[model samples]
Target: MFDKIFQLGLRDILDSMPSEYVSLKEAVEGKLEISLNNGLKHRFDAEEVRKLSSIVPLYLWSMVRIPFIMVKLSSPGEYSINGSEWDRRAISLILNDLGSVISVGQMELLLREFKSLIFITLGYDSISGIDNDKEGI
Candidate 1:
Protein backbone atom coordinates (compact mmCIF):
# COMPACT_ATOMS: atom_id res chain seq x y z
CA MET A 1 0.00 0.00 0.00
CA PHE A 2 1.04 3.64 -0.09
CA ASP A 3 1.86 3.58 3.63
CA LYS A 4 4.32 0.75 3.14
CA ILE A 5 6.09 2.63 0.39
CA PHE A 6 6.26 5.72 2.56
CA GLN A 7 7.69 3.71 5.44
CA LEU A 8 10.38 2.30 3.20
CA GLY A 9 11.31 5.78 2.07
CA LEU A 10 11.59 6.95 5.64
CA ARG A 11 13.69 3.93 6.59
CA ASP A 12 16.04 4.66 3.72
CA ILE A 13 16.72 8.08 5.20
CA LEU A 14 18.18 6.36 8.26
CA ASP A 15 20.17 3.84 6.25
CA SER A 16 23.41 5.32 7.51
CA MET A 17 22.41 5.12 11.16
CA PRO A 18 23.98 2.55 13.45
CA SER A 19 21.81 -0.44 14.30
CA GLU A 20 23.70 -0.86 17.58
CA TYR A 21 26.27 1.02 19.61
CA VAL A 22 29.36 -0.11 21.50
CA SER A 23 29.99 1.15 24.99
CA LEU A 24 32.97 3.34 25.74
CA LYS A 25 34.48 0.52 27.78
CA GLU A 26 34.13 -1.93 24.89
CA ALA A 27 35.67 0.55 22.45
CA VAL A 28 38.52 1.34 24.80
CA GLU A 29 39.13 -2.38 25.29
CA GLY A 30 39.47 -2.74 21.49
CA LYS A 31 35.95 -3.82 20.45
CA LEU A 32 35.40 -0.81 18.22
CA GLU A 33 32.87 -2.18 15.75
CA ILE A 34 29.28 -1.03 15.27
CA SER A 35 26.71 -2.30 12.80
CA LEU A 36 24.87 0.12 10.56
CA ASN A 37 21.23 -0.16 9.52
CA ASN A 38 22.37 -1.38 6.14
CA GLY A 39 24.20 -4.30 7.80
CA LEU A 40 27.60 -2.68 7.32
CA LYS A 41 30.25 -2.74 10.00
CA HIS A 42 31.66 0.66 10.91
CA ARG A 43 34.89 0.76 12.85
CA PHE A 44 35.68 3.46 15.35
CA ASP A 45 38.97 5.29 15.16
CA ALA A 46 41.37 4.06 17.87
CA GLU A 47 42.84 7.49 18.45
CA GLU A 48 39.40 9.05 18.86
CA VAL A 49 38.45 6.34 21.31
CA ARG A 50 41.59 6.99 23.32
CA LYS A 51 40.93 10.72 23.34
CA LEU A 52 37.34 10.17 24.51
CA SER A 53 38.45 7.73 27.20
CA SER A 54 40.80 10.37 28.52
CA ILE A 55 38.02 12.96 28.82
CA VAL A 56 35.30 10.78 30.37
CA PRO A 57 35.74 9.29 33.82
CA LEU A 58 36.43 5.59 34.39
CA TYR A 59 33.13 5.22 36.25
CA LEU A 60 31.23 6.36 33.17
CA TRP A 61 33.02 4.07 30.75
CA SER A 62 30.33 1.41 30.87
CA MET A 63 27.46 3.90 30.84
CA VAL A 64 28.47 6.03 27.91
CA ARG A 65 27.77 4.67 24.43
CA ILE A 66 30.01 5.70 21.54
CA PRO A 67 28.87 7.43 18.35
CA PHE A 68 26.22 9.24 20.38
CA ILE A 69 23.10 9.58 18.22
CA MET A 70 22.51 13.27 17.70
CA VAL A 71 18.93 13.66 16.48
CA LYS A 72 18.05 16.57 14.25
CA LEU A 73 14.78 18.06 15.46
CA SER A 74 11.91 19.52 13.40
CA SER A 75 13.06 23.07 13.88
CA PRO A 76 15.67 24.47 11.61
CA GLY A 77 19.23 24.14 12.85
CA GLU A 78 18.17 22.32 16.03
CA TYR A 79 19.30 18.97 17.37
CA SER A 80 19.34 16.91 20.55
CA ILE A 81 21.08 13.84 21.87
CA ASN A 82 18.95 10.71 21.58
CA GLY A 83 20.53 8.97 24.53
CA SER A 84 20.52 8.38 28.27
CA GLU A 85 21.51 10.85 30.97
CA TRP A 86 25.01 9.45 31.02
CA ASP A 87 25.49 10.27 27.34
CA ARG A 88 24.26 13.81 27.84
CA ARG A 89 26.40 14.15 30.94
CA ALA A 90 29.50 13.15 29.01
CA ILE A 91 28.63 15.65 26.27
CA SER A 92 27.96 18.33 28.86
CA LEU A 93 31.36 17.71 30.37
CA ILE A 94 32.95 18.21 27.01
CA LEU A 95 30.84 21.21 25.93
CA ASN A 96 30.63 22.70 29.43
CA ASP A 97 26.90 23.27 29.02
CA LEU A 98 23.83 21.71 30.67
CA GLY A 99 21.34 22.28 27.86
CA SER A 100 19.60 19.32 26.25
CA VAL A 101 18.80 21.09 22.98
CA ILE A 102 21.84 21.76 20.80
CA SER A 103 21.93 24.65 18.36
CA VAL A 104 23.48 24.68 14.90
CA GLY A 105 26.69 26.21 16.26
CA GLN A 106 26.96 23.61 18.98
CA MET A 107 26.32 20.81 16.49
CA GLU A 108 29.11 22.16 14.32
CA LEU A 109 31.42 22.27 17.32
CA LEU A 110 30.51 18.69 18.28
CA LEU A 111 31.04 17.43 14.72
CA ARG A 112 34.40 19.17 14.57
CA GLU A 113 35.60 18.28 18.05
CA PHE A 114 34.31 14.71 18.30
CA LYS A 115 33.81 13.68 14.72
CA SER A 116 34.11 9.96 15.23
CA LEU A 117 32.37 9.84 18.59
CA ILE A 118 28.98 11.04 17.39
CA PHE A 119 26.39 10.24 14.72
CA ILE A 120 23.91 12.66 13.22
CA THR A 121 20.43 11.53 12.15
CA LEU A 122 17.03 12.91 11.32
CA GLY A 123 14.64 12.41 14.24
CA TYR A 124 10.96 11.42 14.17
CA ASP A 125 10.44 14.97 15.32
CA SER A 126 11.13 15.98 11.72
CA ILE A 127 7.71 14.58 10.92
CA SER A 128 5.90 14.24 14.25
CA GLY A 129 6.62 17.67 15.62
CA ILE A 130 9.01 18.51 18.47
CA ASP A 131 8.81 16.59 21.72
CA ASN A 132 11.48 17.62 24.18
CA ASP A 133 10.64 14.98 26.80
CA LYS A 134 11.46 11.96 24.66
CA GLU A 135 14.42 9.81 25.82
CA GLY A 136 16.18 6.81 24.33
CA ILE A 137 19.49 4.84 24.06
Candidate 2:
Protein backbone atom coordinates (compact mmCIF):
# COMPACT_ATOMS: atom_id res chain seq x y z
CA MET A 1 0.00 0.00 0.00
CA PHE A 2 2.68 2.50 1.01
CA ASP A 3 4.97 1.58 -1.86
CA LYS A 4 2.15 2.14 -4.35
CA ILE A 5 1.61 5.68 -3.08
CA PHE A 6 5.36 6.33 -3.14
CA GLN A 7 5.72 5.12 -6.70
CA LEU A 8 2.74 7.17 -7.78
CA GLY A 9 4.30 10.29 -6.30
CA LEU A 10 7.57 9.63 -8.11
CA ARG A 11 5.71 9.11 -11.35
CA ASP A 12 3.92 12.40 -10.79
CA ILE A 13 7.23 14.24 -10.43
CA LEU A 14 8.64 12.55 -13.48
CA ASP A 15 5.54 13.52 -15.41
CA SER A 16 5.93 17.23 -14.58
CA MET A 17 9.64 17.39 -15.44
CA PRO A 18 10.67 18.92 -18.79
CA SER A 19 11.01 16.52 -21.66
CA GLU A 20 14.65 17.46 -22.19
CA TYR A 21 15.56 16.51 -18.61
CA VAL A 22 13.39 13.43 -18.90
CA SER A 23 15.11 12.32 -22.05
CA LEU A 24 18.52 12.76 -20.44
CA LYS A 25 17.88 11.27 -16.97
CA GLU A 26 15.40 8.67 -18.09
CA ALA A 27 17.68 7.53 -20.87
CA VAL A 28 20.53 7.08 -18.40
CA GLU A 29 18.23 5.42 -15.91
CA GLY A 30 16.59 3.33 -18.65
CA LYS A 31 13.14 4.76 -18.05
CA LEU A 32 10.02 4.23 -20.19
CA GLU A 33 6.59 5.86 -20.14
CA ILE A 34 2.98 5.32 -21.02
CA SER A 35 0.19 7.74 -21.95
CA LEU A 36 -3.23 7.84 -20.35
CA ASN A 37 -6.32 9.89 -21.23
CA ASN A 38 -5.54 12.43 -18.51
CA GLY A 39 -1.75 12.82 -18.87
CA LEU A 40 1.60 11.20 -19.49
CA LYS A 41 2.87 8.72 -16.91
CA HIS A 42 6.29 7.40 -16.06
CA ARG A 43 6.69 3.74 -16.83
CA PHE A 44 9.57 1.63 -15.60
CA ASP A 45 11.00 -1.36 -17.32
CA ALA A 46 9.39 -3.86 -14.93
CA GLU A 47 12.21 -6.37 -14.66
CA GLU A 48 14.85 -3.67 -14.30
CA VAL A 49 12.89 -1.92 -11.57
CA ARG A 50 12.56 -5.13 -9.59
CA LYS A 51 16.21 -6.03 -10.02
CA LEU A 52 17.48 -2.54 -9.23
CA SER A 53 15.33 -2.26 -6.12
CA SER A 54 16.61 -5.62 -4.87
CA ILE A 55 20.23 -4.58 -5.43
CA VAL A 56 19.96 -1.45 -3.24
CA PRO A 57 20.34 -3.34 0.01
CA LEU A 58 23.07 -5.42 -1.49
CA TYR A 59 24.90 -2.21 -2.30
CA LEU A 60 24.54 -1.09 1.29
CA TRP A 61 25.98 -4.40 2.51
CA SER A 62 28.78 -4.30 -0.02
CA MET A 63 30.02 -1.10 1.64
CA VAL A 64 31.03 -3.14 4.69
CA ARG A 65 32.29 -6.26 2.95
CA ILE A 66 35.82 -5.29 1.91
CA PRO A 67 37.40 -5.05 5.34
CA PHE A 68 35.86 -8.32 6.47
CA ILE A 69 37.01 -10.00 3.28
CA MET A 70 40.56 -8.72 3.67
CA VAL A 71 40.66 -9.65 7.35
CA LYS A 72 39.65 -13.21 6.53
CA LEU A 73 42.39 -13.38 3.93
CA SER A 74 44.89 -12.43 6.67
CA SER A 75 45.30 -14.45 9.88
CA PRO A 76 42.86 -12.85 12.30
CA GLY A 77 40.73 -13.57 15.33
CA GLU A 78 37.50 -12.40 13.67
CA TYR A 79 36.59 -10.29 10.66
CA SER A 80 34.85 -7.02 11.52
CA ILE A 81 34.59 -3.41 10.41
CA ASN A 82 36.24 -1.80 13.43
CA GLY A 83 37.49 1.39 11.74
CA SER A 84 37.09 1.93 8.02
CA GLU A 85 36.57 4.96 5.76
CA TRP A 86 34.94 2.85 3.07
CA ASP A 87 32.11 1.81 5.38
CA ARG A 88 31.38 5.42 6.34
CA ARG A 89 31.17 6.72 2.78
CA ALA A 90 29.33 3.68 1.48
CA ILE A 91 26.60 3.87 4.15
CA SER A 92 26.30 7.64 3.73
CA LEU A 93 25.77 7.44 -0.01
CA ILE A 94 23.26 4.60 0.28
CA LEU A 95 20.99 6.32 2.81
CA ASN A 96 21.33 9.68 1.09
CA ASP A 97 20.19 8.10 -2.15
CA LEU A 98 17.32 6.41 -0.37
CA GLY A 99 16.46 9.76 1.20
CA SER A 100 16.12 11.24 -2.29
CA VAL A 101 13.15 8.91 -2.78
CA ILE A 102 11.38 9.95 0.44
CA SER A 103 10.21 13.07 2.26
CA VAL A 104 12.66 15.63 3.73
CA GLY A 105 12.10 14.69 7.38
CA GLN A 106 12.53 11.03 6.57
CA MET A 107 15.67 11.97 4.74
CA GLU A 108 17.06 13.66 7.84
CA LEU A 109 16.38 10.65 10.01
CA LEU A 110 17.93 8.31 7.49
CA LEU A 111 21.02 10.51 7.31
CA ARG A 112 21.24 10.35 11.08
CA GLU A 113 21.27 6.57 10.89
CA PHE A 114 23.93 6.73 8.23
CA LYS A 115 26.05 8.87 10.51
CA SER A 116 25.55 6.48 13.41
CA LEU A 117 26.51 3.59 11.19
CA ILE A 118 29.68 5.40 10.27
CA PHE A 119 30.54 5.90 13.92
CA ILE A 120 29.96 2.23 14.55
CA THR A 121 31.87 1.16 11.49
CA LEU A 122 34.80 3.17 12.74
CA GLY A 123 35.93 2.08 16.22
CA TYR A 124 34.65 5.32 17.74
CA ASP A 125 31.29 3.91 18.97
CA SER A 126 28.58 1.27 18.77
CA ILE A 127 24.84 1.07 19.54
CA SER A 128 25.21 -1.57 22.20
CA GLY A 129 23.28 0.17 24.97
CA ILE A 130 20.93 2.83 23.70
CA ASP A 131 17.33 1.91 22.93
CA ASN A 132 15.83 3.60 19.90
CA ASP A 133 12.91 6.01 20.03
CA LYS A 134 9.96 3.91 18.91
CA GLU A 135 7.51 6.85 19.00
CA GLY A 136 9.65 8.80 16.55
CA ILE A 137 9.78 5.76 14.32
Candidate 3:
Protein backbone atom coordinates (compact mmCIF):
# COMPACT_ATOMS: atom_id res chain seq x y z
CA MET A 1 0.00 0.00 0.00
CA PHE A 2 0.97 3.64 -0.35
CA ASP A 3 1.24 3.92 3.42
CA LYS A 4 3.90 1.26 3.58
CA ILE A 5 5.86 3.01 0.85
CA PHE A 6 5.59 6.28 2.72
CA GLN A 7 6.83 4.66 5.93
CA LEU A 8 9.82 3.18 4.12
CA GLY A 9 10.66 6.59 2.75
CA LEU A 10 10.49 8.16 6.18
CA ARG A 11 12.68 5.43 7.66
CA ASP A 12 15.25 5.88 4.91
CA ILE A 13 15.55 9.54 5.83
CA LEU A 14 16.57 8.45 9.36
CA ASP A 15 19.09 5.89 8.24
CA SER A 16 21.88 7.87 9.80
CA MET A 17 20.25 8.05 13.23
CA PRO A 18 22.02 6.42 16.17
CA SER A 19 21.22 2.77 16.69
CA GLU A 20 21.75 3.02 20.44
CA TYR A 21 22.37 5.71 23.01
CA VAL A 22 25.20 5.93 25.52
CA SER A 23 24.93 7.33 28.99
CA LEU A 24 26.90 10.38 30.08
CA LYS A 25 28.69 8.22 32.59
CA GLU A 26 29.67 5.79 29.89
CA ALA A 27 30.96 8.62 27.72
CA VAL A 28 32.92 10.05 30.60
CA GLU A 29 34.40 6.64 31.24
CA GLY A 30 35.79 6.60 27.66
CA LYS A 31 32.86 4.76 26.10
CA LEU A 32 32.17 7.61 23.73
CA GLU A 33 30.97 5.75 20.69
CA ILE A 34 27.51 4.89 19.38
CA SER A 35 26.39 2.75 16.48
CA LEU A 36 24.32 4.37 13.77
CA ASN A 37 21.40 2.83 11.91
CA ASN A 38 23.60 2.69 8.82
CA GLY A 39 26.11 0.52 10.69
CA LEU A 40 28.47 3.41 11.12
CA LYS A 41 30.14 4.39 14.38
CA HIS A 42 29.77 7.92 15.69
CA ARG A 43 32.14 9.11 18.37
CA PHE A 44 31.31 11.78 20.88
CA ASP A 45 33.56 14.79 21.23
CA ALA A 46 35.73 14.46 24.32
CA GLU A 47 35.71 18.14 25.09
CA GLU A 48 31.94 18.30 24.75
CA VAL A 49 31.60 15.35 27.04
CA ARG A 50 33.78 17.05 29.60
CA LYS A 51 31.71 20.21 29.33
CA LEU A 52 28.48 18.28 29.81
CA SER A 53 29.86 16.45 32.79
CA SER A 54 30.70 19.75 34.36
CA ILE A 55 27.26 21.26 33.72
CA VAL A 56 25.11 18.41 34.93
CA PRO A 57 25.06 17.05 38.46
CA LEU A 58 27.07 13.95 39.25
CA TYR A 59 24.01 12.05 40.41
CA LEU A 60 22.44 12.25 36.97
CA TRP A 61 25.53 11.24 35.03
CA SER A 62 24.55 7.59 34.84
CA MET A 63 20.90 8.11 34.06
CA VAL A 64 21.24 10.85 31.46
CA ARG A 65 21.69 9.43 28.00
CA ILE A 66 23.93 11.11 25.48
CA PRO A 67 22.93 12.43 22.06
CA PHE A 68 19.58 13.73 23.26
CA ILE A 69 16.91 13.00 20.69
CA MET A 70 15.11 16.14 19.50
CA VAL A 71 11.98 15.45 17.52
CA LYS A 72 11.02 17.97 14.89
CA LEU A 73 7.30 18.55 15.24
CA SER A 74 4.81 18.77 12.36
CA SER A 75 4.67 22.51 12.85
CA PRO A 76 7.42 24.62 11.36
CA GLY A 77 10.23 25.72 13.69
CA GLU A 78 9.08 23.63 16.63
CA TYR A 79 10.65 20.65 18.33
CA SER A 80 10.17 18.34 21.31
CA ILE A 81 12.86 16.68 23.35
CA ASN A 82 12.40 12.90 23.35
CA GLY A 83 14.14 11.11 26.19
CA SER A 84 13.94 10.18 29.88
CA GLU A 85 13.45 12.62 32.72
CA TRP A 86 17.14 12.61 33.50
CA ASP A 87 17.97 13.55 29.94
CA ARG A 88 15.52 16.43 29.96
CA ARG A 89 16.77 17.55 33.36
CA ALA A 90 20.31 17.78 32.07
CA ILE A 91 19.10 19.77 29.08
CA SER A 92 17.03 21.99 31.34
CA LEU A 93 20.10 22.71 33.40
CA ILE A 94 22.06 23.66 30.33
CA LEU A 95 19.28 25.84 28.93
CA ASN A 96 18.29 27.19 32.40
CA ASP A 97 14.70 26.10 31.60
CA LEU A 98 13.09 23.86 29.02
CA GLY A 99 9.46 23.79 28.03
CA SER A 100 7.38 21.05 26.41
CA VAL A 101 8.16 22.60 23.04
CA ILE A 102 11.19 24.49 21.82
CA SER A 103 11.48 27.02 19.02
CA VAL A 104 13.89 26.92 16.08
CA GLY A 105 16.03 29.60 17.67
CA GLN A 106 16.38 27.45 20.80
CA MET A 107 17.28 24.47 18.66
CA GLU A 108 20.08 26.45 17.04
CA LEU A 109 21.35 27.53 20.43
CA LEU A 110 21.27 23.96 21.70
CA LEU A 111 23.16 22.78 18.63
CA ARG A 112 25.85 25.37 19.15
CA GLU A 113 26.11 24.62 22.85
CA PHE A 114 25.74 20.88 22.72
CA LYS A 115 26.78 20.08 19.21
CA SER A 116 27.80 16.53 19.97
CA LEU A 117 25.09 15.80 22.48
CA ILE A 118 21.92 16.21 20.42
CA PHE A 119 20.28 14.47 17.49
CA ILE A 120 17.34 15.81 15.49
CA THR A 121 14.71 13.59 13.95
CA LEU A 122 11.22 13.73 12.48
CA GLY A 123 8.39 13.67 15.00
CA TYR A 124 6.15 10.60 15.33
CA ASP A 125 3.34 12.49 13.67
CA SER A 126 5.54 13.48 10.76
CA ILE A 127 6.45 9.85 10.35
CA SER A 128 3.06 8.42 11.28
CA GLY A 129 3.36 5.96 8.45
CA ILE A 130 6.14 4.25 10.36
CA ASP A 131 5.65 1.85 13.28
CA ASN A 132 6.58 3.19 16.71
CA ASP A 133 8.22 -0.05 17.85
CA LYS A 134 11.00 0.28 15.31
CA GLU A 135 14.24 1.03 17.11
CA GLY A 136 17.04 3.35 15.92
CA ILE A 137 14.85 5.00 13.32
Q: State which candidate, 1 or 3, has the greater TM-score.
A: 1
Q: Which candidate is the best by lDDT?
A: 1
Model 2: per-residue Cα lDDT over 71-93, one tens digit each: 11121121222224444344344
* lDDT at 93, model 1: 82
lDDT (0 to 1) per candidate: 0.83, 0.32, 0.83
> Model 2: which residue pairs collide?
none
lDDT of 1 by residue, 1-137 (tens): 99899788878868878889888999999998888989888888898888888889999999999889888887778788888899999888887898878888998887877787788877776767756454321
What does each candidate score in C-alpha RMSD?
Answer: 2.8, 17.4, 4.7
Can you tell me which runs of candidate 3 are displaced by over 4 Å? 1-9, 127-137
Model 3, total clashes: 0
Candidate No. with top TM-score: 1
What pairs collide in candidate 3?
Answer: none
Model 1 residue 73 lDDT score? 80
- Residue 13, model 3: lDDT of 63
